[model samples]
Target: MKGLCTGLAAAAVFMATGCQASEPPTQVVYRFDDHRYLELKGWDCEGELWYTDTKQGVHSQIASQFYRIFTKKFVHPSERYIAIPWWGNITGGFSVSKDYGQTWETGGASMSPGENEPDGSNAPYYDDVLSFTVVNDQGFLQTKHRLYMSSKPFDDPRILPGGSGITYTASDGAVHHIKPTSSGPAWGLDYITKQGLKEDTAQFKTNYQGLPDKVPEVKGYTGWDHMRCDMGVGR
Candidate 1:
């Protein structure tokens, strides 16, 4: 019986240390700028603002500022436009800039501020507007914990189905899910969907910090121009 016990122990040891462990599932790496994220990247800090034009090799200066005050949280869907969730004040609503940053005009009153208003909505209801994205002409803005979307840019933004990791179809007829990423924007992550099989190249990690090592064949994009669509996947 003692010999039987010893043999069992030896078998257990072999099972524990004989073979290598499997690697973890490959997760997508997202790069974004959150108030907490800018520190991880290289930038010139000034007061509450951290400015950098060459973030990950992108020609854009991000003035990381506080949520309130005159600081504007803007999103540039294209080189010709810059959109903001709040124009100037809490009730200022949204705004947009067409000719670069040369000028900005109010878009609409999607968000308003007040106290104890009806409809269970008021100043603080839609406050804390953070990241904004334009997927196929449909505008989606992520707030403190909820997602508000609009059919058009700066139009009436309404709350979408709550909770993260929920899949939804965009106005462009494409499916998207706000999945986790290692890196985009200042949030250290952003939204993405399973884009189905790779056309070329075997499966590999696409971690470029912010600059792509090679320019992909994409339309309307000049090699590393700071314009990152689909995390610079070019698809």
Candidate 2:
């Protein structure tokens, strides 16, 4: 009887530990506003991107198998457009949304210039990308070779012509010229209020500290393990 009781107690403890171990760690990486934010759920630096919009009562996974180190999230000032550029060991792609976070489409633009061209001609090589930013509802990918800009309200971004300098017509029926030196449009995240930034920072710190020590095992072949994993916040 004593042995049976001991075995039962041990089983209960094992079950409890298993339950705790199964719960993957989660952290709020970036906050667009009080109502909208981006979270990471999985292991320490490898996970999926989950977008939450409290105002719309929407909580959905935007992208999967995201490595926090190489992935970045960009938002328009009005929160109407969001873009994510991610890279794996051998390949990389973009995931974009036009109507906020309602829906997401992957593989819109290519980091390699002219890859989208039908014949795959002109600058067929991959550009050494340095940074990506969104300004004036447009996405800009700065590379060591040249700067690539997308059209306004970037849902399906196509690399614009003329490299860093280009003249294009705005949706407002006005012709606008962008020079390499011109810097009128500011970063979309810059428009976020100070209070919002403060809250987001605090929340991130709290969530990060609470992450589990052991990374939960991901079942099945996700094909994302090759993605670069490092330590950093997804901006």
Q: Report the lDDT tens digits of candidate 2 across residue range 201-235.
A: 21122111232222223233222222234353332
Q: What residue runs in model 2 are displaced by over 4 Å at the alpha carbon?
A: 71-78, 87-91, 106-108, 111-127, 154-235
Pick by TM-score: which candidate is best? 2
CA lDDT, every model vs. true structure: 0.31, 0.47
TM per candidate comes to 0.27, 0.53
Q: Which stretches of candidate 1 lie over 4 Å from their true place?
A: 1-75, 86-90, 98-102, 106-109, 112-119, 122-130, 134-138, 144-146, 153-235
- The 10-residue segment of model 1 with minimum total lDDT is 194-203
Candidate 1 TM-score, C-alpha based:
0.27
By summed lDDT, which 10 consecutive residues of candidate 2 come out lowest? Answer: 185-194
lDDT of 2 at 4: 100
lDDT of 2: 0.47
